[model samples]
Every structure is written in structure tokens, then in C-alpha cells.
Target: MNDRDVMPAFDMLMEELDAIVTHLNQQGAQLMQAKEYAQAREVIVKAEAVLAFQAKVKALQEEWVRLSVSSSKKTPRKKQPGQRVMTTMLKQGLRTPNEAFMLPILQALVQLGGSGRVIEVLDRVERMMKEQLNKYDYESLPSNPKELRWRNNAQWARLNLVQAGYLASDSPRGIWEISEAGRALVLEAKE
Candidate 1:
């Protein structure tokens, strides 16, 4: 490829990498405040990517410096650090049906106790949630894969308990013991 074509693509990739890095460095608390789980998940992935890109950039710079010195060419220009080019944190995610399905189940899982569903678990769930999770006024959790509303306080307890890996429901039958993963979620929540 011609130098002209090569340079622009590299420049564009660098610009994108820079933009990703800026986004990734946001405070952990700010990331948690994300309104949706999917969005938060994207941010975490992007943040990790940013860190990766920075590592790549650093490695490239080191190699470039070595090559330039060997070839007796002037060092390539370097962009100043910490300035954004693309400049936006766009809204994340499509409200697709599949996401809609998994979301409620996940949110419901979060509500029920996730690890354990004792009184303390319920209390913690209520507190972590910005909204109330009671029977009468329980708002819809995010939709899951099947478009089930994941509605009902019964869901609140059931999903969370199930997700915590404790208490697998046989549906109209009964729940079994909590799994180790369930125990972990409960323990983490408590901590």
C-alpha cells in the first residue's frame, strides 16, 4: 500500500484508540450509575479495550523509536496526550428483543437476593435498587430474552434467589440448595 493510504488508516486507528482510552478512565462510581446493565457492560468492555489500546500504543512507540534510530530518519511526530478527537459518549445499545428478554431476568435476579434471600438479602436488594420492589408498586425490571415482564414480587424473590445460584426452582415443584456461585453472589453482596 502507498504511504498515504497507510498513514491515514494508522492515524484513524490511533484516534479511535485515544477516544476509547478517555472513556475507559471514568471513575468506577460513575460507571456504576449507568441506568442499564447493558450500557454498564459496554463501558466496562470499552474501558478494558482502552487500557489495551494504550498498551499497544506504548509498545508501538517503543518499536517506532527503535526503527527510526536504526534507519536514521527523524522521529515521527507524536500527538499530545489526553485530548479527545471523536468526543462523545454516545447512548449505548439497541433495545433489541433478545436483550429485553435477558434483562428482566437479570434484574429480577439482582432483586431476589442473588446469593441468599433472607430478610437481610431482601433489605439489601431494596437498598441497591433506586426504586421500590414491593408487591403493589413493583415496577417492571428490564425485559429478558422472552419478553416476559419478569413481573410480580414473586419473581423478585425467585429470580434473585435463583441467580445467586442458590435455590434452583423445579417450577410448581420446589427449590433445591444454593450453588457455590449463589453463595458467592450473596457473600459478595453482603460484603
Candidate 2:
């Protein structure tokens, strides 16, 4: 179903989940009061099932967000007569290669001793890209005026690296770090 349909379903699911949680809580409380150990265990098992369903719903929401972000598109603006176009390194589009940004991000993390804030890493990646890749500029997606498309690619690369066990996810908010595997990957790539 489309988002329009899914949204209502999501809301309904949330309501159902809330009701289930309330029921579970009440039942557990009652069982505790009666000191019914066996029934309490059953309630605990039911609570686990509720948690599983909640997790599924959360996963669905996350997937929706990812798909929506990646599928976003923007139309290019017509340049005025005197308007100079930005650097011609690569044209803007969904086709921009993310691989070019990955190594630079990894290298930036290594230079920072394998950990840093996201924005700091992003700036480092940009500088490295300009110097090493000769990528003077990248076009921004239509949905964003101040953001460059390659930056998004870099973020995706970071996510992929995290999934590949090359980055750690336990850092502070807005912070990322290279795992031991990432350092090894960098060394291997160099060789």
C-alpha cells in the first residue's frame, strides 16, 4: 500500500499496540497481586510477543523513512543570463556515485583517530574530495538548496560501512567511529 494508506494503518497499529500494552500491564499487576506465579509467567510471555510486534512496526516505519528519503527528487532551476554555473565536476542527479565519498569519509575518521562528530567528518570529507578527487563541487538535490547531494551519498556510505562492521554504532549522538575492521579495510585498500 502507498504511504497514504499505510499512515492510517500505522496509526491504527499504534493504537492497537497501546491497548495491548495497557492490557498487559493491568494483567501483570493483577497477577502479581494474586501471587499467581504461573499466570505471571504467561503474562510475561504475552508481553514479549507485544514487544516483538512493536519492533516490527518500528522496522516498517524505519523502512518507510529510508525509502522516502532515497526516492526524493528535485528539478533543476534555469540559470539566468549572468548566473554562472557551479563547478562542473559532476552533474547533479540520483546517479551520483557514492563510492567516491566512502574512502574519503573513512580516511577522515582515521585522521581524526578513528572517531569524530558527523559534521566534522563531513567537512573533512568535502575537503578531501576537493583535493584528492578534484571534485570542485556537487549539485544539491532539488529538495534541498543548502545541502549537496554527495553529502547524502557520504552519509549512506557511512550507514553501509556501519552495517558492514567497519563502523561502530555505540558512539554519542552525531558521532561516528571506525571499527578495527574499518582500519583493516583502509590498510587493505592502500595496499
Candidate 3:
């Protein structure tokens, strides 16, 4: 069955389990009042087991949510030879390489005084590289149709920059910042 069908079923199961636990607790209390200590202990132990199972199920549900959100953000690239050939054929003379965004991104951050919001940085970078950007760059990405291809390339470039230590890895979310090394590289380039 699909997620929509299974999710409600899981919810219903959890609710039923909660009711069962409540019943067990009430039964244990009644047994305690009647001085049946061993029976009360057994009921409490069963309730604890059910609670533990519920905890595990909740953890699994959380993990599933995390995985689904991450997977939906980006499409995975296929390494098949046929897919590679098709992509190469389709992309001929169209988009700029990811590296093309590096200098502009660093420059944009520098201009913004070391850090800026993602959209602001990208806007500045776009103005800087206007002539270099091609028609294909303006098109939407296949993976995320709402995002432009060049913006996605720029984001990939930012990821590479972070990996190479040219950008700050611990910067606040939605803000892009250049590192000291990145600034020095820009200075060295100017020399």
C-alpha cells in the first residue's frame, strides 16, 4: 500500500496502543487496591513493553520523514553510459561549468562585506556574469523545475567551495560567506 494509506493505519495503531496502555495502567491500579501485587507488576511490565515499541515506531517514522525530505530536494544522477551520452548530447554548448560561478560568488560575498543572504549573493553574481550566462542557464532544472539551471549550478559551486575551504562551512543557513582564504585568493588574482 502507498504512504497515504499506511500513514493513517500507523496513526490508528498508535492511538489504539495508547488506549491499551491506559487500560493496562487502570487494571494495574485496580489489582494494587485488591492487594494482588504480582498481577499488578505483570500488567505494568506489559504496559512498559508497549510504550517501548511505540517509541521505536516513532523513531522509525522520524527517520523516514528525514530521508524523504532529503531525497525530494535533489534528483540523483545516473552513471549509466547511455544516460551520460544523452546528457552530453543534450547539453552541448548550453550551460557553463560549475567552476564558472566560483569567482563571482566570492566577489559577490566580498562586495556584500564578507556575507550575504543567498538570494542577494546570487543576484549580484548574476549581474556580474550576465554576458557569460547563456539561454540554457535561464531554463529550469530537470530535478527541481522551480529553480533555474544556473542557480542550481551556482549552488553546486558553493558546495564545492565549501569542500575546498574557500567558503565558510558553519555559516548560518540561507547566508553565504567567503572565507579568509577565499578573500586572499581574490587578492592574489588581482595582483
Best by lDDT: 3
**lDDT ranking of the models:** 3, 2, 1
Off by over 4 Å in 3: 1-89
CA shift of 56, model 1, Å: 1.5
- Give the lowest summed-lDDT range of ten residues in model 1: 90-99
- Over 148-187, each residue of candidate 3 has an lDDT whose tens digit, in order, gives 9899979987986786577999999999999997897688
Q: Residue 166 lDDT in model 3? A: 73
Off by over 4 Å in 1: 1-16, 24-31, 69-191
TM-score of 1: 0.26
Report, for every candidate in turn, its global Cα lDDT versus the true structure. Answer: 0.43, 0.71, 0.78
lDDT of 1 by residue, 138-171 (tens): 4233322232222333344345445433455543
lDDT of the structure predicted as candidate 1:
0.43
Clash totals in order: 12, 0, 0
129: Cα error in model 3, Å: 0.2
lDDT tens digits, residues 98-151, model 2?
Answer: 556767788899999999999999999878777444332365744456877777
C-alpha-based local distance difference test score of model 2 = 0.71
- Model 2 poorest ten-residue lDDT run: 87-96
Question: What is every candidate's alpha-carbon RMSD to the true fold?
Answer: 17.5, 15.4, 21.4
